[model samples]
Target chain A: MRVELDVPKCVASGQCVMAAPDVFDQRDDDGVAILLEERPGEELLDDVREAVAVCPAAAIRLVEG
Target chain B: MSDALACPVTGASGPLPEYPLPRAAECPLAPAPAAQELRSEKPITRVRIWNGSTPWLVTRHADQRALLPDPRVSDDDLDPGFPYVNAHRAAIAPVSPRLITNTDAPEHTRLRRTVNGPFVVKRIEKMREPVQKIVDDLIDEMLAGPNPVDLLTAFALPVPSLVIAQLLGVPYEDHDFFQRSSSLVLDGSVPADEARRVSGELAAYLDNLIIQKTADPDDDVLSEMAGRVQAGEMTHTEAVHMGVAMLIAGHETTATMISLGTLALLQHPDQLALLRETDDPKVVANAVDEVLRYLSIVQTGVRRVAKDDIEIGDVVIRKGDGIIFDLHAANWDPEVFPGAQRLDIARPARIHQAFGYGPHQCLGQNLARLELQVVYGTLYRRVPTLRLAAAIEDLEFDHTGTTYGVHGLPVAW
Candidate 1:
């Protein structure tokens, strides 16, 4: 599985970081999401999915194969 | 349809249950009974609001999630169909400056960007140590000062005021002034003139503070906004208003959560025990979200005007129609949260809409959550004997304010 973040659409609510800190982080300057792991391990999948689900701007996408 | 279901004002087919329906006295913690019923029976239905305008009240969690982010939905308060929370909001809409709260993208996206940097989860996490200090000091003061104190004034109210003041670089010495003025501004029952007066005072105060920060900037949110104003990224007034917005937005709502959240814990001894006994930060954090889900404190539903015709489920919301997304209703929706009425701290409840959803969701939510986590984690453990000094029935609840909270939480530890 892979993760994507549309930084333009990110509202900086930080729901993604709260859901999956290992998979996501926010920029210190403007809080736009930063994808830490483009392709996370299986153990982190559920948390990544939650990050995708809860991002207020709907900026995070989990591309599944 | 039966004549009984016909709305008198709109001649609509179903009864337009009034918007901002009163909560049942017996279940002070829950959303209005009628609103929950509407979630199940008529997820998207019209309801009359303060100005006699009939706006569609979207009650279901699924429906709110689907509709709030749609481009057809608008945050513009200037639209004729926009459902103002009350008369004061209606009166002030025309003169209000464009801010992150009232604009849509790309304007909202721009305005929000100028301020979002400091509030991100990482930025807020840095404050946990300081926030813990604030909580500890306040608890110490409470312990030293009096027994059975009014927790609302003693601890709950000061926590956010002090924190926000330090963050905004506003002098905590003026907290009493800002707190009082901000309270008047949020009170729905306050007359339009009085609300305007207090809001103006707050704006002017911040405007002056911004000018000072511009000269000798401090390490704070207001300073960052002031830098933006200098860089031509935003207007001077915009920076000032943003400060007021942060104070008004972050202050009372967080204070309410502290007070009402404590009240909720005291009411549910089992849940209180879990919170008190837990040494895990994750447990404390999850408990904070669960309590947020349980309370869903913001009573005035997120309001918007439909910019274009949009079809969802069976109803078609026409262009120029108004919509209200009842966060409490959606948070309590049984489809998403089974046994929605129960206040269980162990639930996986981060999905709640208490901070709302979409781009206009609460900007200070991460910070608010951090404050809550600190207080919920520390207070119970520090004062294991904490109990309500007053009967739940005897407590007064503020129904007219933007956020629902108790007037005074008398607590004895």
Candidate 2:
């Protein structure tokens, strides 16, 4: 699974960080989401999916295989 | 039932249940029973609002999740079809400057970006210790003061007021004035003229504060916004309006949660015990979400106007039609949350739309959660004997406001 964050579309509500802190973080200045890891381990898949589901701006996408 | 009755005012034939159906007096914590029934009977059906307009009320959790982020659904209250919560909102819409609350993307995206930095989880998380101190001190003050005090005035109201004041760099000394003004602005029961007058006062207050913060920069959200105004990213008026918006948005809602959440916990001793006994921050955090889901306090369903026709399931929402997402109903949707009515603190309830859903979701959510987590985590633990001083039936609930909450919550430890 690969996680993609459209930085410009991010509203910075921080659900991604709350859902999958290991995979996403927010920049201190604008609070736009920054991907911590593009391809996290299989263990983090569920959390990543939750992040995609809850991202208010629909900024996060999951590339699943 | 036959479609015999006509709306006396509009002469629209049919019995459309009102958008905000009345909650059962006995079960004050639950969503309106009629609203819950609509989720199963007619997930997307029209309901009459204040202005005699029948807007489609979307009740199901799944439907709200799908529709809120759709481009066709607009937050632009300026649209003719936009369902204003009341006359005041309708009157204010024409003159109001575009802000994060009232604009669609590209515009909303640009405005929201300038202010989101301070509210991001990482930045807000840094305030946990200070917030904890605020909660602790408030509890201490409550302990020292009169017994069986109105918790609304004592603790619940001040926590967010002080925190928001500190965050916005507004003087805490001026909180009494702003708190009263902000509540008046949010109170739907207030006469439109009065609400508008108060709203103007708050805007003026913030406008002056922004001028001060601009000249003498401080480490705060308003200061950051002031800096943006200097950079020409946002206008002076937009910065001021945003300040008023944050204060009005953050103050009463958090206060309501604190006071009302306590009432809920007191009602369920077993759940209250879980919170009181828990040393785990995760447990407390989950408890806050559960209570938030249970209360679903924002009574004015999120209002939007359809920019284009939207089809879902068998129904077609025409372009220029209005839509209202009943958060209480959606939060209690059985498909998303099985045993939906039950307030199980242990339930996986983070998906709840208590802060709402979509790009315009609450910007102060991270901060709100932290404040709640701190309060829910600390208050119960510090005052283990804490219980309601007033009977449940006697307590007055403010149904007319944008958020539904108690007028006064008397408690004693």
Candidate 3:
């Protein structure tokens, strides 16, 4: 599945990273989300979903293949 | 014939004047007086409000969490023309852009979207190294000094303050300005005029920073915001307001938690010992939640307003009525947290109200958690022999303000 983030909506709170580290990582300086891959492995679905749910700004979304 | 006597709700009762209503000054967390009483009764009784009516105090965990995000209630304090003036005048004055704390959905969602990128967990994890380095440097400075040091001034305050400053692309040299302004703004007793002056100065400084970032784009979030402004995605004023909010909220809450969390852990030696031995991140994570619940540094969630007449429990709240979710009282409620008062680092399945609930929950929670996890992990490991320098009774807790914290925490290793 592909994950798309509305970067403008993200606040860099790190909920996505804490929930799904493999798929999402932050930039070194300002701590903004830097997705590692557009489509992550199937096994990481639970975590990615949690990220979507917990994001205070509701910035993350899943694009199922 | 003797007339039947009835208890009048508005007038005095018998010879002993009716139970005097509880003024903000009489409230334990009041700023005017240091000797306010803490009403910790069972079943969560209603307290007579100074505003001439009584609002039910939902002291139990289940009740508060259940009602916090209820559609019937609201978070807007301005609908009734700011009733909290008697309570929070000094804390929020010379208001900038409407803050996340005061806004609800739609509007809140829109405002939060402007700068949500910096706080995502993935982004924050990338900050682990830098944050750890910041913590390490602060600790090094603390150890460089004498044995007994004020952890509040040295380690706890600086780490978060510097991290937040860096995140906003504000120079670390301006840490004093940010720290002082935040302190004054958060202090409920500060005069409104002084608070406004400080806020104006901070806003002007932030405005300058935003302009510089606009002129010369860089990798920092501020530069990104500047870029967005140029592209019409956001305005320069919006960026300034958000930046100021993030800087103030980011550092103030985390700094208070670190100091108070440490004090909590130190007081409970068994919990501290257990935390020291645990290497598992999950275990450490659970411990962080417990500390948040136990200390509840942010005493109450921001006020919410009732959009329409609503009934919470047995009480009927009229439209536009203001409600505050008492996080501290909720966290300590026995119905939700069995043995709620005890500080158990290993407490499992603990859901805390420290970050509020539903859509308006704290946007910076994850970053706050990451800071706490790193700070607590390194703190106990590096300063294994750490202990309080002053007696527990002597410690002065600043519960009078919105952010509850000890005035100073002196420690020795």
Model 3 agreement with the true structure over B229-317: per-residue lDDT tens digits: 89897888888887777877777689888988888788678888989988998888889988888776665334555688766555676
The reply for model 1, stretches above 4 Å from the true place, is B1-14, B171-205
lDDT per residue for candidate 1 within B1-413, as digits (tens), equals 11111211111224878778877676778788788778888889999987888999998998999888787899999999999999989899999888787899888987787788889787788888988888899899999998989998888878887788778877768867866777678656689999999889888888998888899998888888889899998889778777777877898899899999998888788889988998999999899999898889989999999999999999999999999999998997878888777788898888899999999999999889999999999998999999899988899999887889988899897
CAPRI classification of candidate 2: high
Candidate 3: list runs displaced more than 4 Å: A1-65, B1-46, B81-97, B172-199
In the range A1-65, model 3's lDDT, one tens digit per residue, is 88999775555556677778888987543455778878888899888987776554557899867
- Model 2 per-residue lDDT tens digits across residues A1-65: 77888887788788999999999988887788889999999999999998998898788899975
Residue A7 Cα positional deviation in candidate 1, in Å, after optimal superposition: 2.4
The prediction achieving the highest DockQ against the true structure is: 2
Q: lDDT-based ranking, best first? A: 2, 1, 3
The CA lDDT at B193 in model 1 is 98
Question: Global lDDT of each model?
Answer: 0.85, 0.86, 0.67
C-alpha positional error of residue B185 in candidate 2 after TM-score superposition, expressed in Å = 7.2
Which lDDT value does model 1 have at B198?
86
